[model samples]
Target: MISAKRIRIEKNQEVSANYVKKKMDFINYLDNDSLAQIFMLLPISERITMKEVCSKWQEACQLAWHDIKKYKCTNTIVRNHKKCILTQRYVEKVLFNCGIYLKELILSLICDSSIMPIIAEHCKNLKTLEFALVEFGNKNTYRFVEAFTQLEQLKVVKIHISGYNFQFRMLNSLPKDINEIHLFFKPNGSPEISFDSGIIKSTLFTTMLFNSDPVAPSFFSLKKFTNLRSLTIHRCIITDIIQEISRKTTLVYLDLEKCKTKKEIFTFNQLLNLEHLNIKDVSFMDIPNLLSGIFNACKNLKHLDAPDFHVDLAEIKMENWVNWRNLVHLNIRWQASDAIIENIIKHCNNLEFINIDELNSESTIELTKLENLNHLDFEVTNIDNEVMVAIINNCKKLKHLVLPEYNMVKASIFYDLSKLQYIESLNLAFSFKLGDSAIIAIAKNCKLLKCLNIKNCNITSSGYIALTGLKNLEELNIEMSVNVEDNFVVKLRGIKSLYCSGCHELTDTGIIQFIKNNPDLEFLNISFNTNVTMDTIIAAEEAVKNRTNDTFLAIKSVDSDIEKACHEASKNRTNDTFLSIKTNDPDLEKACSESQWLIDC
Candidate 1:
């Protein structure tokens, strides 16, 4: 009944509609793995929006959500009350969607404690939880603490309470499955909670308490944790608590920084399994006895940092440490005599790292006998030429060496060290007499050098030229080296971070040349170079804009007047410019905020 032409027109229209549908539904053809990868790249905010795009995108987002391992909820609004309810709801939605696989959650904002149940119901796999509460009171904190009882998988919990006076009763209600706990309480705000040893009996791995109060309540007994491995206590004087803890726990690591305790309170004999011990800021007159006890009992001790112990080395026999073959790292802040150094070398043959307060020529020579010494830090009034040569010849495997700030050995020291091909990091900062010759010798010999610090030295432009031969140089700090000029910038080839602050001889033209040559530079510090002007800033902005790759450049300067000029110049620039200029000038900071370019003044 229909004509042939009309029938053909209807069939053509149907074919065109079919083609349109295929084009619109093309994303459905992608496999779930490919779609999941694409969704994983989206930000949490954007991922939430993609869920509504289509069924395929929703499935992809769900798959991506399973891959998320950590999430944080921080205050995003300027005013606290102005944070609309929608923000909380949106966060809840994210938690409900991604909580299935999240292992860590950090909460810093003010959220209702009722939300804890929702998190527990969703994030069953959560292992680490960190809460930083400042203004929030303990009104609903009980609910937050109670919800964790249901999370059997939670292993670590850190709570930082400040500004508000939180009751300690809630601490007694924590889950028993948590293996590690860190509690930080500001002065005067921490409440006095009674001891409930049963609550923390199962927590037997690690515990850290940093209480600012001078006279904090010893609420809990440490004797309950028989399986405790690591313990750290700060500020609070818990002599009795530590004594009980030492008697009960076979701790492997102990940190008593800034903790005040009687000498008789701690006994190291029971802590035979102790490996790492930090007693920094804890003063003890009878340190020799304490060291003897630790070295004799804790033979497995590997890392010992007792920089603040006021002990007379002459009173203790160095032979006590001779049997500590397992000792690898030792840091002592007290002065040691030549005899003490000789004894340490004779006994501690396996030591790879040593940091001492002072060492003389003889002590330095004795250090060469340790073939395993790779990292050495010592202070000396004068660095003898023979001592430097002795170290270079004996410690050929030296990778890190830090000399005294007061010592200024002659240029020949570098010539001797040039033979040490394994040196990777060399710091000669504050050595006023070190000049270009030393750097030249270093560059020629140490081809593997990666980090060099010559701050406050007497290096000139010629010295920087010597650095040009260092192909592996990554970080260079020449702060206060005023003689270094613009010509040195061109020779910097592979450096990622350059600090030339106080180099007054460097000009704006020189800075632009350096920026152009090193397009991949990430950090550049030319602060205090009075010759730097607006042109240098403009060149940095252009370099970032023209780059094909996504690289960030951070330039630091102290010239307030030039920074203002650069801010004004950037007004017409596009937002795609990724240059960041950090200055301490107030006017420049205000101007930067108004401009489209990223500024951190």
Candidate 2:
């Protein structure tokens, strides 16, 4: 019933709507600033594309460029690429935009003369600073010396001064509140450099001697460090530092590595609060003076790690047996003298964990019979079957036991281990004498066992069947076991971490089946299993990547097949899901070494 005029008006309204939409699209395309702002909200990888939008957009980003620079929420920042002069400028630009307030800073490069000064002025609030590869001449070294005086809150500083006859005015310019300091100087001859310890609380001297000097006060002239708590001297033969530490009562942790002393016979009696002491590579085996200091003064000693100990009772007086109630972790490595073991047995009643890499029968006497022992490692060269039985019977509370290499007996060796019901982590690897019977006995007992390493052991497929009952098991290392087949992995559904590495008989089908079944598994090492193909690895990696946050799902598979899968997964890792792949490659190891927190076991 409508007229011709009304129909015409409706058609015109529809055309006008289409024209307005086209005009709005054109406006959006022209506004580069607005586009850049929108791009800023996207992820880092996506934002890289914004640079190509237009020159105007790139200029707009300059103002808010701090948002574009990378941020490391973790402890370390590892960049793969190398830096040059131009790259340094770019780095500076990014850092400037990111703001100068930093918790830690490591500048390792061949920077310009003025770079240090700029950093000192800008990074006033820096807590830890490590200058690694920078080189400076004698005159340029003093340029940034006074600049650090403003950094009043600095705690730890490690700087490598590389130059001959370098004027290190920083000694005088250093602030007094610093708790830790590590200096590396490369100077010609005996270019004297001294530090004012008025502000230092806990200091470490890591000096590489360029030349020798007789009159120098050595590395440990503590006339100023009255508040020092811990000290570590490395590579320098300045034994005078030890004498200085003898007077220090506040010292708790003392590490002296490769520091030679002229006087072999030295006694210490001063340090009362010293708990952890490590004196290594001094070459003096029969050090009675050092022993006197340790036995008498360090009453609060908790953790002791001395690798070279002579267990000779003839050398140590029998009447000097002092009780160390506070001793907890005792590690006596490579005891050349078996008599020292008796000395340890007499004292160290409160010892909980004892790691003896080399212990003879003479040393294993009354100490192994301790009821308080929870963790014990022995590399006994001269151990009888009776001595082993005594160790197992007496130390019923033992949770971790690692026998010496080439020291495995028959299956009857584990007959006494049933008494140690609390044993959790057992490493009978390289013990070829322990057959399936031993493993079966272990499964029958030691229900708390979590980590069982039978690598290079004589374990057949039947041995793995016994492990099916170990529901609490987490890690199992059965590397190089020829008898372990595909069905053996089926028994490991509860296990979170598994190492079937070098199982040449294992194929892709077995691995696929295990992955499909064990959804709780987080770490699986199929390295050296050549039968596992790339297709199967890819499928497993994809399945793991789709899992939830609490599910770790790590594949520690090496070789070309696994590496290819990992590379593909890494390229697609976008969401909160993290994929960690461990390989024999150096690059992979380096990556793993960096992310220490991600390691489960």
TM-score of each: 0.71, 0.58
User: Which candidate's lDDT is highest?
Assistant: 1
- Summarize candidate 1's per-residue lDDT along 288-317 as a digit string, tens digits: 556646665677888888765544555554
Alpha carbon lDDT of each predicted model: 0.69, 0.60
Q: What is the lDDT of candidate 1?
A: 0.69
lDDT of 1 at 218: 51
Candidate 1, residue 587: CA error in Å? 8.4
Per-residue lDDT of candidate 2, residues 374-478 (tens digit):
886654554567777777778888888877555646568765565678988887778878888778888888889988888888888787888888877888888
Which residue pairs overlap in candidate 2's backbone? 176-199, 311-339, 311-340
Return the TM-score for candidate 2, rounded to 2 decimals. 0.58
